[model samples]
Target chain A: MISIRWFLTLTLIALLVLVSFLSSLRGYRESMAEAETLFDLQLLEHVKLLGLLNPASFLFGNTLVIADSVITTPAELELSLQLLVVYQIFDREEKLVIRSENSPTENMAAFEPGYQHAEFNGYSWRALVAQDPLDGHWIMAAQRNDVRYRLAEAVTLQAVLPGVIGVPIAGLLIWWIVGLGLRPIQTLAASVRAREAGDLNVVELDDIPKELTPLTQSTNDLLTRLAMAFDREKRFAADAAHELRTPISVLKVQLHNLLHDLQSRQLPDAAVQTTRQSLQELGQGIDSLAHLIEQILVLNRTTPDQYMRQFTRINLLALVQDVVSNEFEQILARDQIFSLDGLPAFVSGDDTALRSLIQNLLVNASKYTPLGGQITITILQEHNKVLLKLEDSGPGIPEQQYAQVFDRFYRLPDAHHDASVTGSGLGLAIVKHIASMHQADIQLSRSQNLGGLCVTVIFQAYQQDNPA
Target chain B: MIDAVVIVLREVLEAMLVCCVLLASSYALGAKRIWLLPVTLFAVGGALLYATNLTALTDLFDGRGQELTNVLLLMLTGASLLFYLAQLPGVITQKTSGVTPALYASLIVASAAAMVRELAEIFIYIFSYGIASGQTAPVVSGAVIGAGVGVSLGIFIFFGLLWLGKRRCLQVSAVLLSLIGAGMMSQATRFLVQSGFLPGEHIVWDSSWLISESSLTGELLHALLGYDATPGIEQLAVYFASLLIAILLLRKLSVNQSLDVDSLRH
Candidate 1:
C-alpha cells in the first residue's frame, strides 16, 4: 500500500530543493558578472580623475590624493582595497611625477588607455592607465585584484544563502500542504473503515478529489455487484420454494386422504401392509425434497464470499461427536459398527459451517454403508494442523467420479439406480464450500482398513488461551 | 540540493524500479496483497543488520561482512528471479493451478533481497548525516525530493511496461524484466572482482568520453540496463550468461504454452 501523501510530500520537497539550488547557481553567475561590470566602471572613473589633476601637481613630483585614502597602518576591517585608491603620474620618459602617499613608484601598466593587470610587491593589482594628450603624461589608477574577487563571491553568497537556509522551512510547508491536499482521501477511508461490518453500501462523500473519484466509483461498482448477487440468490430461493410448495402440499393432502379412506373401507390385513409400504415411499420422497431444499439453502449461505466473515476457534472432536450421535440411530438400524477416535482438536473456522460439514460426512457414511458395516470418525492434532478423518465400510466412489461428485446435484449412476438408497446430491458440494472458507485442505481416498471410503479435512490449528 | 538529490535518487530508483516491476507482475498473477509480508520482513531485517553490524556481523567474516552480505543477497535474488521466470511455463500451459506457489515464493525472495540491499544503504546515509547539525535542511530536502522522484518514476515505468505488455506479446515484458535481473547480477559480479574474490583484467574499455556514468541518462541506464562506464570482461561475461539463461527459459516456456494452445484447439 503506497500512500499518496508520502509520495507527494517527498516529491514536493525534492522539487523545491532542486529548483532552489539551480536558481541560486544561475543567480550566482549573473551576480558575479554584474559585480565585475561595476568594478570595471569604478576603475575607469578613477583613471580619468587622476589624469584630470593640475599639471603643477603632477610637475611637483609629489604625492597627491593619498592623505584621505592611503593607510600606512590600518585596522583589520580597513585592510581591504575596497576603501584604498592608489595612483601615479608618469612622463614620456616613464619617470614618476606625483603619486598617492603609499602608491609604489612603479608603472601600474603601460601608458595605454585600457585595462590591464600588473604586480606590485608580491601582490597582483587590477589597473586602468590613461594618458592625457595635452601634457603627454600618463595617469594610472589601480586596486588589488583579490579585493574584486572577494566582493564578487560576497555578492553571489548574499543572494543564495537565504534559499539554502529556507530548505527545511520549505519542507515543513510541503508536508503540511500535502497533508491538506490528502485530507479528503483520508476522511473517505476512515468513513469506510468505521462503517458496520458487512455493510457494503455506497460511500457518500460530499466533496471528492479528482484523483479519488475513480477509486470511489470502483468501490461503489463492487457494492452494486454484491447487492445484485445477493438479490438474485434471495429470489432464487423464494422462487424455488414457491414453485415446489404447491405440489408438496397437494401430495401431503392426498396421502392423508388415502390413509383416512383406507381406514374407512376396513381394508384387509395384506392390503393394509401394501398401503403402508406405499405410504412409506411417499414419506421418504417428502424427506428427500425437504433435505434437498435445506442442503441447497446451507450451500448458498456458506458460499465462499458470504461465509468469510464468520471464523472462530472450534473444537473438532466435539463437533464430530455431536454429528456421530445424531446419525447413531441410522447406523444402529443397519447394524453398523460405529466408533469414535482421538482426543480434542481445535481449529480456526466457522462453527456452523464445520458442524454442517461433520453432519454431512456422518450422514453420507450412514446412508451408503451396508448392514453390519463399520464406520469410524476421528480428530487429531498433528503439529500445527488439526486433521478430521471419516471412513466408512461401503462401496467407495471410483477415481473418475471424484471431481464430478462435487458438482451441484450430481449423483453417481449406481446411487441413482439403487431403489433403497436416497440422497439430494448436495451434501458434498456444501462440504466443499465450507472447507474452502476455512482454507482447509480436503481429500478423499479408499479407506485402507475399512475397505470403503475415507474423507479427511486438514485445518490450521488455532491456539486458544484457556486455562480452565 | 540538486547534487544531493541525484546521488540519493540513483540508488533508490534502481531498487524501486525492480520492486515496481515485481509488484506489477504479482498483481497480474493475483497475489499482490500478500507481498507486503516479505517486503516488511526484509526491511526490518536490513535495519537490524545495520544496527548490529559493528557488534555482531563484522565478526562473522573477518570484517568483510558487507561485501559478503551483498554477495549472498545478489545470489539469492538472482536464483529466485530465475525460478520466477521459469514459472510462466506452468501458467502459460495451464498445467498447474492459477498463480503457482513456486512463483509466489521466488518472487517474494527476489523483491525482498533487492529491497533490503538498496534500503539499508539509504538508511545509513541519511541517519549518519545526523539531524541535529542545523545544516541538514538542504540534505533532508534533497533526500525527500530524490525519494519522491524515484518512486514516481518507478510508477510510470511500471504502468508503461504493463500497458505495453497488454498491447504486445508477454515475451517483451519478460525480456525487459530478465534484462534488469541480468544487469543487477553483473553488478554483483563486479563487486566480487573488487573484493579480490575473482580475477579480473585492468580495464575493458573506457566509455566515459562518450557518456560519463554519473550523468542523469547514464545513471538511469545503469539502473535499468547496468551500463558500466568501464565494464571488465568478467562483468560482461556474467551479464551475457544471465541474459542467455533468462531468454532461453522464457522461450522454452512460451513454446510450451503454444503447444498447449494447439493441443486445446485440436
Candidate 2:
C-alpha cells in the first residue's frame, strides 16, 4: 500500500501544480483582455480628440489643421497615444484625410460597409466607418491591430509567466511544506523504525499533525496487537519447552540410574526385571517428550501469519476416504470399527493442512474410544457450506470443555488422562487454525447416537465467481 | 477551455500512473486489509480540494492571514516528505501483498479531484486575464492550450518513467513521490517570495552559467528549479542552503541503507 505520507505529498503537489497552472493561464487571459480594452478605449479617445479639433474640416474639404493654440496639439496626443497604435481619419469616399505615418495599405476603398478586421503588411487592423452628420461625409478610422494585440500579449505574458514559474516552484514549495506537514508522521515512523522487534510501547502523540492523528492511532493499535500476539507466542513456547524438558530430564536420569545399578553388581532376576521395566518406562517418557516437541512446532507453524500453505480444490469425499483407508490397519489393530457415511463433498483448502486437521480429529476420537468402539466419518453439503463430522463411541467432552479443548495444551480433568496415552495437547489447536485459514468454523459436541465425542468442521462453499 | 481541460487531463493521468504502481506493488505482496488504500486516497483527495479553497480564503484576508496559511502549508509539505522517506525501507524490504486494487481505485479518484480543482482555477485565471486584456478570446485560448499540453506531456512522461522504473526494479513510486514533493516545495517558496514574506535578496552565490535567467529557456529553467533571474543575496543563499541540506540528508540516508545491508550480511 502507498504510505500515507507519499499519498499526501502527491495529492498536495498535484493540487498546487494544477492551481498554479490554471492561475497562470487566467492571468495571461486577463492581461490580454485588459490590453485589448485599453487599446479600444484609447482609439475611441483619439477619434474624439481629432473630431474636436476639426469640426467643419470635412465639409470645407480643406485640411482643417487647427493652430497649436486653438486645439489640443499632436504633442499632447503623444501621452495618450502611448497605449495605442496608429490612429487615422478618412473622409467621404474612404479617402485618407488624416493618417498616422506607420499606417500601411492606404486604400480606403477596401473599408466595407460594416466594421471589418484585416491583416496587412504583417500587422492586424480593425477599422470603423461612420457618417459625419455636420460635415455630410463618411468618416472612417483604422488602427494597427498588432500594436493593440502586442500590448495585450505582453500583459498576458507578464500575468501568466509567474504562474508558469510559480506552479512548479509552488509544487516544490508544496513538496517541502508537505514534508514539514508530515514531520509528525516521519517522527512516528522513525520512532517505530528505531524500535527493536520486542519493543511495543505506545508512541508519543504530542507532536503529531492533526491530519495524521487517526493514522498514528491506528498504528498504535496494530502495535498493541502485535505486542499481545508476540507475548502469547513467547509464553506458549516457554511453557512447552519447560514441560517437555522436565520429562526428558527425568527419562535421562532414570536411564543413567539403571545403567549405574547394572554396573554396580550382578543383579538378581527380580532386580534385573525391575531395571528393564524402568528402562521401558523411561523410553515411553522420552517418546512423549519427542511427541510434545513435534506438536509444539506444528502449533507454531499453524499460526495465522505463518499459514502459507498452497491451497487447492479437492473432493472432500475422496480425501476423507483416502485418509480413513490409510488408517484402517491402525483402526483394526485397536479392534475399532471404521464406517464412512454421506456423499462426495467438494471443498478448497491446503491439502496438507486439511489432512492434518482430519487426522487430529480422528486420532482424538480413536484415543478416547474403548476397544470395539465404532467411528463414523460423514461429509455433507448444506446451504453454502460443507460440513464434515467425525464421531466415535468415546466419553464425550463436557460443554464447557469443548471450548477449552481448542486451547493449546489444554486437557479436560474428567477426560482420559492415561500416562501411556500418546497426546501432545496441540491437535485441536492446529485443527482450529487450519479451519480458520479456509474460512471454516469448527465445533465440538456430544454425538447423540454414538454417546461419544463429535468434531464438526464447516467450510464456506466455493462459488465460481468467488474463488477460495 | 478545451486546452485547459487537456492540461488537467494530462496531470491527472500522471497521478494515475503513480497510483497504479502503488496498487500493483501492494497486490503483488498479498496484503489483506487492502481496502484502506482507496479510502485513504479519497480522504486525501478531499483534503487537497479543501486546501485549495483555504488558499483562496486566506488570500481574501489580511497579509498576516495569507502568510500564516502559506507557512502552515509549507510545514505540512516538509513533514510529508520526511514521513514518506522514513517509510521507504519498510515498503521496500517487506514482502509484497495483493492489496492494491482498492489502493489504486482511491488514487485514481484523488487524482481526478485534483485535476478538476486545477482546471477550475485555470479557467478563472483565464477569465480574469481575458477581462484585463480587453476580451481577446484567441489569446486566452492559446494560453489555455499551452497549459493543457504542458500538463498532458507531464502525465505521459510520468507514466513512461514509471514503466521504465518497473522494468529496472527501481521502485518508481518513491522516486516519483520525491520528485513531486520537490516540485511542491519550490512552488510554496515562490508564493512566499512573491507575497513578500520571504526576502528576495537571499542570493548565496551566482550559478547562472548553466542557465542564465534572462533567456526564455533560462526563465523556464528558473521556474522549474527556483532560479532567480536577478538573484537577491538572500534568495540565492536560502536556495543553495536548502539544496545542500537536502543533499546531505539524502547522503546520510543512503549511508544508513548500506550499513543495514552490511549488518544483514553479517
**Clashing pairs in model 1, backbone N/Cα/C closer than 3 A:** A14-B145, A61-A97
**Residue lDDT tens for model 2, A1-468:** 345565565656555666666666566667667776776666566555666656434442344333345548676556334434454466665666665545553654254544557666576677655555676444445666755666566656655655555556665776687678767767887888997554687777576777878888888899899889887986788577767777677777877787777767877879777877877776776877776776666555554443433556778888887777776776887899888888877787777678878877887778778789989998899998999999988877778777788888777674454444677778888888788878899988889789888888998775766566
What digit string (tens of lDDT, one per residue) describes model 1 on residues A206-228?
Answer: 88988899999999999889978
User: Could you give candidate 2's per-residue lDDT for residues B1-266 as a string of tens digits?
Assistant: 33434443443343343344334333333335454455455545644554456557565647455555544454344335434444445433433432234333433443333333344444445555555557445445555445544544454444444345332222444444444445445545656677777876554556577666555466344324544555555444445555554555455545555544432221
Using Cα atoms, each model's DockQ against the true complex is 0.09, 0.04
Among these predicted structures, which one has the highest DockQ?
1
CAPRI-style quality class for the chain A–B interface of candidate 2 = incorrect
Q: Count the backbone clashes (under 3 Å) in each candidate.
A: 2, 96
Best by lDDT: 1
**TM-score, candidate 2, chain B alone:** 0.54
Most accurate candidate by TM-score? 1
